[model samples]
Target chain A: MKNNHPVDEEPPIEKPPFFNSWKGMYWLVLGNLAFMIALFYIITKIYE
Target chain B: MRPLDWIVLLGTIGFIVIYGIWKTRGSQDIEGYLKGDNSMKWWTIGLSIMATQASAITFLSTPGQAYEDGMRFVQFYFGLPIAMVIISVTVIPIFYKLNVYTAYEFLENRFDLKTRSLAALLFLVQRGLAAGITIYAPAIILSTMLGWSLTITNLVIGVVVIIYTMSGGSKAVSVTQKQQMAVMMGGMIIAGIMVVSYLPDNVGFGDAVAVAGKLGKMNVVDFNWDWKTSWDDRYNFWSGITGGLFLALSYFGTDQSQVARYLGGKSIGESRLGLLFNGLLKIPMQFMILFIGVMVFVFYQFNEPPVFFNEGTKSKLYATEHATELRTLEANYSSIFEEKKQAMQSLVSALKTEDEAAIAIAETKVENLNAAGKEVREEVKALITKAVPNAETKDTDYVFISFVMKYLPAGLVGLLLAVIFAAAMSSVASEMNALASTTVVDIYKRSINPNGSPMHYVNASKVLTIAWGIIAILFATFASMLDNLIQAVNIIGSIFYGTILGIFLVAFYFKRIKGNAVFFAAILAEVVVLYCFYFTEIAFLWFNVIGCVAVIVFGFILQTLIGKNEKELVKV
Candidate 1:
């Protein structure tokens, strides 16, 4: 069965999903945290 | 250097040329010539894109970078996969939808004629000069290492590339690139294995990494964000996401060299997949190359290497009066370097045992000793340069090739040389093709003759390819003057990529912005980016961010202000 949406209507703009969103600003913050955590882990391993 | 090796080198080169010409025999028209009649597959496009970006610089310098630094260089590519996904979804659909020849072609339709022209011109100048440097870079290595004349090396690179590029155009480039990529990957893997095999029997692969780790060559990732220090400039999360995004966007979305690669794709999905393929493979491929370099560094530590890696300069220096000074410096370097190597092994053992105090002691001594060894090597290299006035003394560029020559077997050496040649040829061929395409399509065909025959345009492209080939040779020869040829070309790109990207961004997003406003804004932004590059010490990567943002913000402001005034004045 066909949907009732108008043919000429503009499609909704999709947001970049929680992990990939916000000026990519949040993504940047989380990414830095992850990288630091990983780096420190490597350093600790290397030291050990 | 053996008869069989020579045979392999000549045979590989001969087959690529003949096969290329045979496959693309009748590609005489402009569309067939430049775009392979738009019938390439996804895998072919993916390989072609990889080949174009991985020039001889990748083979020659990346290992040197690894040997000097470590696997940390691999992090620079961390953002590439994500960048690829973004391009595939947003940028890919637009170009495919437009059915454009050059990426710049879409700018005219989206914005205005001037916008297209401005972007096209920027690509031409930057790419044309860079194409020369690529050709020149490999030639410098071949000539210096083989003790051949620079002129001969330059001509060989130019003539060999021109023959295939002019003969088969884009089709020849893509097909040959497939073979080239295979050979390059195979050769590098073998070279990496050979480095391990050449190690002392006591030092297995694990031990080598331990040795490398002790020497501080195993530090693959740096977390500190000290902006002022250029030495540890890892592609951080922010730079990778923001700057890398803009760079990938401008490069794939605008640059003709790359656009031409995908333009040959048969369908939109194929082209998009090809790009996605690159995004997947590039980071890991870079990691492998850097890892190979780390192994080379470990190999050198176990076996004493030359004071200066460039054998060409060492030979000339030995023949001169300054030989005595250089020899003394080398003797000093030999002893200190050995001690440093021992210190590295101790550090590794300390780390293995989880002895905190021993680790601290070993790390400090190892660092100090490593610093002293570097100082002595520099002093020796300086003496070598003083000994031979006219000799080219940059040894970092020669580190990998020197290893290849000293260690790799006879036939494998030829294969690796061919790999370097193939890498250089693939990149140079694409640049020549893209340069010709942009020249004929954007400037000549549009402005000079809007209705020229395909035959006529094809002929013009061949002529332009040869002309640019000559230009590249000249650039390649002089490229030695620059401290690092790879960095020099990249610096040039950083200056122009952002503004061009900005213009493209405005065309895609700013629906209300017209061509003239964006075009002028591009000009203004380019000047500012250049000023930042010259006057400021901001790392070259940051320039991409500055250029892209400046153009977008400036274009919008100019567009809105002019747009509003025009409407108000019209009402009056």
Candidate 2:
């Protein structure tokens, strides 16, 4: 049992593509969610 | 099936299976077998992740859901993108840190072996059954529609998956998924275009969509909730975000089928990127599927749809004493559809006129006819039950496939069928690979044979992959029809998902709760969730929330009491 977990060891840090930090990537996902919800809401109104 | 349709279907599946075998030919060690020796790039992992989740049921039932209920079903996935982000940020990094083979392995280091084993057992119980349903759900549908044997259809899906999955294991599942995803999306896009084009020459794309919207089929987002009534509402913004988030976390973070996808990634960045890709693309993909269903619903408005979609069930009804009654209902349905079709044409014209009053008038007429048609269909379902007591009565699952088989061109029919099979194989292959790796890494290699050579574990995994595939095929072969295919699978998932999610949540975030505490808590939480499922009127999605919260709360209380008792013992 290679017991090295719950280790909280930081992964070898590298810049994610098209983002300076991982934070940017996370925000992009969350932001996209917000935008999609808004866009869907608009579609619902326009259609219904 | 036409000869050309058969050619397209067979040629497509044959090439994918051969490609998967060729690409991942010589996986000699357990790491390469189970994790692809961490050689997968982000894009492959991303497509593989998407393919693994989009089983045949997604293609089959989703459009039907839209046809009957409208596009409000798309709201169910509102939480999934958020879920993808959560996994990418938190779950992926820890997995990379540990270099673990399965998600359960991290539990062993953080908790005790029992906790790890308990989680693994939970996964095996849930995913193993799910793998069977993955094949069975589609096979049963195809069998009834095409007059094929259910057993043969199940083997057709099961054997192909088992072949490639056993050949290269995890790498094979990923390698072939890229092709499967292409086929699934391409076939669906073509189907969507064909459906829209199949509308009468006068009905432009805009008119078709406008007509669908007017008919209340464009419902994509629902944000409102009532405290009393909304608790059991299956699809809404609130439930999707909260319950869907928990379910996705458990699935992607804890479930081996999904964990294996990203675990094969080349590095932390690759894994994270893979998940993010799914997050970005998954919702739109679902929207497209549901929208196609909406377009099909629109298509059926102009062209006369069958009184009953399940022709097989209807044929059985046709033989019974109720045949005359069924014929009468079909006549009524036809009479109502002829009027409804004209009303729909008027509605399209009204929409073109941009006259709100005229549009409202046409909409009411169409709604009335639609209601009349629905009542006739209900009468047909009731008649089916009276005639054939054992046959399945729900026809929504057949809505999309019936359209494809009856209306789409020959080669396109084959391509869409390939979409369904590719989706099934892609998902089944992933599950078999995941099941094998979990059985080997978590149970066999770790506990059963800790000192065995890498090659021995690799061989064991191959055997287990074939074994799981066979078991899935057997289960699919014998499984009876459920009420709704997609919901049946989701219900099974909801039953076990909450407790598994809770355990992983504790392991990942709640450091204070010891392994024993959370282990027992997970068991107790499972009991509570099952109680909710059987005893309460709670919606299935809420089970994810209920089980997760129960584990944390129960673990905390138990941990506190254990800490008190230990202190007293130390003082003595």
**Which number leads on DockQ?**
2
Itemize residue pairs with steric clashes in candidate 2: none
TM-score of 2: 0.97
Give the worst 10-residue stretch by lDDT in candidate 1 chain B.
B230-239
lDDT of 2 by residue, B360-446 (tens): 999999999999999999899888877798888899999999999999998999999999999999999999998988999889877
Q: Quote the positional error of residue B219 for candidate 1 in Å.
A: 2.7
- For candidate 2, give the lDDT of residue B393: 83
Looking at model 1, the pairs that clash are B132-B472, B136-B476
Q: Where does candidate 2 stray beyond 4 Å?
A: A1-13
Model 2: per-residue Cα lDDT at residue B444: 89
Residue-pair clashes, model 1: 2
- In candidate 1 the C-alpha lDDT for residue B34 amounts to 86
Instruction: Report chain A TM-scores, every model.
Output: 0.53, 0.68
Tens digit of lDDT per residue, candidate 1, span A1-48?
222323423322233224344335334433543564376348525723
